[model samples]
Target: MLNYRLFGDLSSSAAPLVVLHGLLGSLDNWHTFARGQAGKRTVLAIDLRNHGDSPHVAGMSYRQMVDDVVAVLDTLAIPECYLMGHSMGGKVAMMLALQHPSRVRRLLVVDIAPKAYPPRHQALLHAMVGMPLGELSSRKQADEWLSATVKHPFERGFLLKNLGRKTEGQFYWQCNLPEIARHYLKISGFPTTDAVYPAPTLFIRGGQSDYVADTDLPMIRQAFPAAELVTVAAAGHLPHVQTPAEFTVLVEAFLG
Candidate 1:
């Protein structure tokens, strides 16, 4: 089962809010958002397969990831919940809602359209997978080396979250980097399903992010006809992280 963190009461009268992180992200990345929502309802932050503390499996298919989450929900006895996700996780949420509409009472997708994206992270994946973990003695060294390919401080730090220490004290990547690289195209592509999720849904995008283009709206509307779109002007790619207060407000308003 996928590793997950649950907050709020198990018997909370409200359906839980299940949050899924983006590519190269773990449950820890959504701590702020989950905590903010947990105050009013149960919140489940899950580490998708091959990321974070979850098992490092070979495939990264949205179907597989969706099932992984379903397995966790089944284990926890959560019949349905307010589901949300960011980027790649957004795709998973979209798939889950479409594949299992009864399990999602409401849906919130962040910064991703229900269409395929080109393979943009291959170079970065290769860089991370090809890192000399055996020679790196410190996280600082890893950061310095990664800086060669990943220049932005924030993104570099975010990617470094995958670094884990072996029992012998050597640094290793906890995320299944090699397999992610191999299935980069699959990850970029959306799942093959003509099914649409006819539920009250909200799509939040970062004004500074190009991940969700205006051109993608028709397709998004087609798949999620009940979807409402919102943009956080001050944020880019990661509005929940960049503007937590504003994002939290939007989420709460939607849930209500």
Candidate 2:
């Protein structure tokens, strides 16, 4: 079972909002956003399988991830709620809305399309798997070592989120590196589902991100006929981080 750490007041009167983190991310990534939505709605931030405190499963397929979310929602007795996700999480949210329409009242996808991404993330995953954990001294040292293997600083930081040190001074990864490394391809690919969720869907695109290019709109529309697109200017893959105010405004309007 996937362990999910929730936030905010679950007993709030407003409709619940479940936020799923991206690849290599945990519920902590959505702390600010979840806090902003507090009182207005109950925010349930999930740490997907193999990330954060979640259990490591044998497979990393979207179907398996969706099942994890379903289990959490059912356990919470949340009848229907708003679904929001970013990058990998966006794909999961898309699948959940498609396969389990009754569970999602509103769908919000951030900076990703309904297409398969290239295996470009393989190098980063490889570097993570190859990290010299035994010799790693501190997080700064790990950062310096990872800098030699990974070029993109932001991406390196994202991967570094998994690095942790034991009380005995031995370093390890908080994430299940072997599973993520072995299933990199599956993680980048979206599942093929014939089900189309016609619920009012919102696609929040990052202006600087190529993840959701104009060319992908056709596929998005083909699957989600009622979906609408909104772009956050001067933002990249994680718009909520770059432009939280704008992202919040857009989300509030969409949820209304």
Candidate 3:
């Protein structure tokens, strides 16, 4: 099972919202947004397997990931809940809704489509896997090293969130880098499924991102007949992070 943090009143009449983060991301990425919605609805932010405080395992398939989510929900005694996920996590949410439709009330998939994606994160993965944690004296040095492959400072900072200090000066990655790198292909590709989840679904895309293309709508509609697509203006892949206020409004309205 994955480690999760709960916000708001779980006993409230409002249906609980479960959030799953993207690849190389943890529950912490959604902390602020979850906290913002805590007053109105119960929110559960989870660290998927191999990320953040969750148990590190070998297999990184969508099936295994969905099982981990189910385990968390089962332990919480939550029969069903609203699910929101980003990037790779969005794919997980889609799979879960298909495999166990009864467990999902509403679905929100952010900046991803239910189709196979070409290998795009290999360079980033190589940089992350090749980071010399033992040689790094400070997070700044680690950032400098990553900057060789990761050009964007913001992205480097985001990836640096996985850096954890074991001792006073030594830093190591909290994520299971080796396993993720090995299963990169699986992570990039969506698992084959003929199953359809006949529930209300929302696909939120970033206007600046190519992750969700016009070609994906037909597939999305075929799987989720009631699914609707919305785009966040001036936002990229991480729309929730870039345009949080707008994102929150969209979510609250849809979930309501």
Candidate 4:
């Protein structure tokens, strides 16, 4: 099972909310949001396989990722709960809802659609893999190295969160870069299914993100008959991080 951080009172009457983060992101991405939601209900933030503190396994597929989450729910004895996921994680949530509809009470997919995406993060992945972790004297140096490929400071900082120091000077990535790279194709592709999840579902897209396009709505509706899409103005791919306040409001309204 993937590593998870739980917040809130598990014994609360309200159903738990399971949060999954985007590609190259960990449970930490949802830490603040999960902590806020924990006041009313249980919030479980997960590190998908190959990311964060989770085991760096060989294969990467939607089925494998879904099973990892299911194992966590089974271990927690949670028969049903709400689920929210962003980007890559959103795809995982959608797959889980489709394959195991009864296990999901409500579903929220952020900034992604039920379709295949072209490999867009190759440069980022290459930068991550090529970074000489052993020689890095400080996080700043690592950031400098990443700056060559990852021009955006915010993105560089976000990716740097995965950098961990083993000793006084030596550093390594928390994610399994090699395996993720090997399975890039699988990660970019969505698994096909005739299955449908008819539960109330909300798809939140960033106003500036092309991840969820108008063309994808019909397919989304076909899979999730009750799904609705909302846009977060002036936000990009990571709307939860970019405009957390607005994002939280949308999530709370849907989950309520």
The numbered model that scores best in lDDT is 3
- Measured over all alpha carbons after superposition, the RMSD of each candidate to the real structure, in angstroms, is 1.1, 1.3, 0.9, 0.9
lDDT of 4: 0.92
> How badly does each model clash, as a count of residue pairs?
0, 0, 0, 0
lDDT preference between candidates 2 and 3, better one? 3
lDDT on C-alpha atoms for all candidate structures: 0.91, 0.87, 0.92, 0.92
Tens digits of per-residue lDDT for model 4, 1-256: 7899889756765679999998889999998888777556789899999999999998999999999999999998888989999999999999999999999999999999989888999988988898887788999999999999989999999999999998566898889989998999899999989999999999999999899988889989999999999999889999989998999999998887
lDDT per residue for candidate 2 within 124-202, as digits (tens), equals 7777888789988788888888787787788678778788778899999998989988888999998877789999999
Clashes of 1: 0
Per residue, candidate 1 scores C-alpha lDDT tens digits across 73-155 of 89989999999999999999999999999999999999999888888888788889889999998999999988889989999
User: Candidate 4 at residue 82, lDDT?
Assistant: 97
Across residues 1-256, which tens digit of lDDT does each residue of candidate 3 receive?
7899999756766569999999999999998899898568899999999999999998999999999999998998888999999999999999999999999999999999988899999999998888888898888999999988899898888899999998677899899989999999999999888999999999999999999988889989988999999999788999999899999999999998
Cα-based TM-score, every candidate: 0.97, 0.96, 0.98, 0.98
Ranked by lDDT from best down, the candidates are 3, 4, 1, 2
Q: Looking at candidate 2, what is the lDDT of residue 16?
A: 88
Which parts of model 4 have CA positions greater than 4 angstroms off? none
